[model samples]
Target: MSQSLDRALTLLGSLGDGPVSLGQAAASIGVHKSTALRLLRTLEEHGFVHRLSDRRYRLGGRVLSLAQRALQGIDVRQVAAPYLAALHERFGCTVQLAVLEDDEVLYLDELTGRWSTGAGLPDRIGRRAPAAGTAIGRVLLAGLPQDGRAEEELPAELAAVRRRGWAAESSGHLETVTSVAAPVAGSDRRAVAACAVSAPADRVSPAELVRLVPELLCTAEAISLAYGGSPTPRWCENRCGARPVVRASRT
Candidate 1:
């Protein structure tokens, strides 16, 4: 790589130790303090670094925004498409794939199942819902680390979801609807999205929906693995033990 590019990347990596002063960065990277300041200024102009009031430099919001956009383009929905269709075929319940976006569950894809009510559960693709209320939300939230928000700010149902490793809701977002969801994790074992099945409450009563937990969990694992998620002990027992196996991404 060019010297400037190499130096910039070296400086970026150095900031991982937290904010650094020009002298500290120069000494660490084997560059003069003046050269380090010039590089830092270039990075600041691009919003890749921020100079603090104390004259230390740290990462900037632009870097965070870029990382978020990269995560959003991970193609989990594409990776899970066939599995979702198979899940829909098995139970004939609406199958949905969603990701948590700014405290809301943003529906990325949906497959209408055979048992769809055709009334209560509308086509949810391109739609969003509060993350504290829906089954998918609970599953996604359960996978996240606890942030010390007030208990009242979070729904009590999340506790049950964490304990059960899954979540289900009756009349969720729509009257007479029942929805069950499981987390779809990434390579880091962090839930990047959720897989959910929705049907009319009368047709797929909560008790009957409970019976589908195994299948839902299995499908989620299959999708998670396809997306490069590290396999858990349960997943190791029989990795992706589901039908219509999804092909893992080569990338």
Candidate 2:
């Protein structure tokens, strides 16, 4: 790396501790005050650092914006691929990863089992489904912060999904299909993506999908941990015992 660039990065990293004076910044990067001032001035111009009233400097809001954008661009599909494949292998059902995009469920990845070839699901990658109608989309919605939506106004089924940690839909939009979904959380314990196992109703009944709930939650938790999220909360950890096997309803 260029020596100047290295020094600048080191200086930036050190500022993360707190605002730092010019001498402290120079010492952090093993440079003289003039050299450090030059680096700080360039960083300030780029909105990477902010000079304080006392002439100390700290990380700037632009740094946070950049970090957020980088996190948003991460390819979670690659991280969840192995888990999706294993779920497909175990259940002989189609497995998918999805996120809420533009009020729709956008599929990022899928592992289709033979039984799901004609299941009539949105099995293709990049396919989008109404977020309130699909199992995975409901799970994503239930897992999200309220934003502007009120909890009391949520559909009862979606409310249940929020409490229990997963959602299952039978014959929603496509009457021949059944799908069970759970949220894959991020470091903040918010759903970053959703994981679902879908299949033809004849191949996997709603009861069968309900039975897969525990394993599905486990799979989601595994992916969440790998994706730097907190583990499933105790309430969500109860899994099979949390709710009886009920027929999945279109929400």
Candidate 3:
């Protein structure tokens, strides 16, 4: 593997246990402290890693987002594209693929409604969102590992999503947008990402959002299976889908 890829996996493996000091991380990864710091810094810039107030490092919010996009740009999205487009056409709304990084939700890819201003929003392929208010955020938050102190409220609805299989939001994150999301798992049987749909609150209801759960779950699972993830994840899953599509392929 390339040096960067090797370092990233090392960082990820180290983070699976809990937050650690830079020194510990360097030692665990068998790299010089300076080299580890440089790698961490690079990962931080891409949203794949985070640095705590104490200078400890953790996973960042962009990791999931980028991973999902990477998967979509590969084979899973290509396979799911028709399904995603069909869903968008049926609902005339926006469909989003989201993944967890740190304590946030990151957009992987989206299919927007004809009348939607989704393109105007900052939710490009790698845009990040607070994993609190939005339905996608709730879905991701619900799937996050309980390894470290979250430092955020774990709402009942979000908790319910973990118990159940989905979550919804009604004009919570945005002023008038309603959303529904479902968890996606990784090979470790953990929730790593989610798939969601969003529409104008005026045009969608809580019941309707709940009804969309199965479809979102299907999409998420398809992506997860593509990534060789398990049928069930312990926390969250990575929906890379089975195929690896690079951004260059999209371009």
Candidate 4:
């Protein structure tokens, strides 16, 4: 790699801990003071670094903007499509992908399963639903930080979902329909979206739905991995507080 490119990347990596002085940055990257100053000036010109009042430099707004643009380019629906299809094939239930948008659950994709009753399912892409009333919404809401939301401010259902690391609803939002969901986490180990399966209440009893949790979790993990997120067996223990007695063997 070119010396400038290498130094720039190293500088970017070093800033992860916080701002750095020019001398400190140069010493850390093994570059001369003059060379480092020139590089910092270049980075500042491009909005990649900000020179602080104290003479230290920190990451700039453009870094965050670039990160956001990169994330926007990653189509979660595209990444999760095969997993959703596999889940549908396994359970023969309507599979849905959703993300929190505008404080609501926005359906990104849907695949009708053979046995799905299809009642109350958000069949179309871009369908919106109240986050408090749907399985996917509950999982997404549960994954959000609770500090700003007072205990009373949070819905009881969402609190329960957070405790359980999963959510299920019977005849909720739509009569005679059942849905279960889990988080599709990103690299931050937070829900960027959710994966859910819906079926007729009669076709999928609560007990059967519980049995499907392992598959649901595995599918979610697969999607998370596809999105460059870390996936570990500990997800069940950390998020659900319960480990699957019967782990789903990778196929």
**What TM-score do all the candidates reach, one by one?**
0.62, 0.61, 0.55, 0.59
Model-by-model lDDT, in order? 0.80, 0.80, 0.69, 0.78
Could you tell me the lDDT of residue 237 within candidate 1?
A: 38
Cα error of candidate 3 at position 232, Å: 4.7
- lDDT by residue (83-190, candidate 4, tens digit) is 888778767878888889767987778898666444544354646789988888989988887777765577787777866678988766587777789998776677
Give per-residue CA lDDT, model 3, range 111-217, as digits (tens).
87554654333344656777886777777777777676453555667668777778777765486777788766666767766778887666667678767666666
Model 4 global lDDT (CA atoms, 0 to 1): 0.78
Best by TM-score: 1
Error of 4 at 188 (Å): 1.2
Return the TM-score for candidate 3, rounded to 2 decimals.
0.55
After superposition, candidate 3 runs with Cα above 4 Å error: 1-83, 117-123, 148-155, 232-251
Misplaced by over 4 Å in model 1 are 1-74, 147-156, 233-247
lDDT of 1 at 36: 92
* Model 2 lDDT per residue over 1-251, tens place: 99999998889889867899999999998888999999999999999999999999999988978855654465677677777887788778888888898799888888887875455554457567799988999999888787767777777877899888999899768788888999988767889999998888887789988898888987887677666677554433464232222212212
Better of 1 and 2 by TM-score: 1
